[model samples]
Target: MPTERRIGPARERDRLADAREDERAHAVIRNVRAARMVAGRADSAEECSLLLEMLGLEPAAERR
Candidate 1:
């Protein structure tokens, strides 16, 4: 009976973690789509690169 009780909460934690992961994945997809739209509207190569960096779609250069 005691072992059964512990198992229930463990299962619940796993389920909650899965739900949170799903939510995070969806958010990343939305951000990528928005970044792509902004990139499309960008006027020049430099402007598009800056916009993508701002949206975190591209990694910024390291400062010396």
Candidate 2:
């Protein structure tokens, strides 16, 4: 039981680290780091669009 409890927090910490790294990667590409943060949450292109619309923000300007 003790071992099981340790594993849960370890896994959660790892997941949070991965999420932070993902946003850091995005920060390098876009002005608003938050964009990368939100993009990480979206499961699909459609979902991303919906999120953007709701936030009243435009899609990333046509990637070169």
Error of model 1, residue 6, in angstroms: 10
RMSD of 1: 6.0
Compared with the true structure, what per-residue lDDT tens digits does model 2 show for residues 1-64?
Answer: 4555455888999999999999988865664555666788999989988887776666777778
> Which run of 10 residues does model 1 get worst, by summed lDDT?
54-63
After superposition, candidate 1 runs with Cα above 4 Å error: 1-7, 59-64
Candidate 1: what lDDT? 0.79
Give each model's whole-structure lDDT: 0.79, 0.76
lDDT of 1 by residue, 1-64 (tens): 4555455888999999999999999988887788778767999879988888877786334559
TM-score for all models, in order of appearance:
0.63, 0.44
Model 1, position 60, has a per-residue lDDT of 31
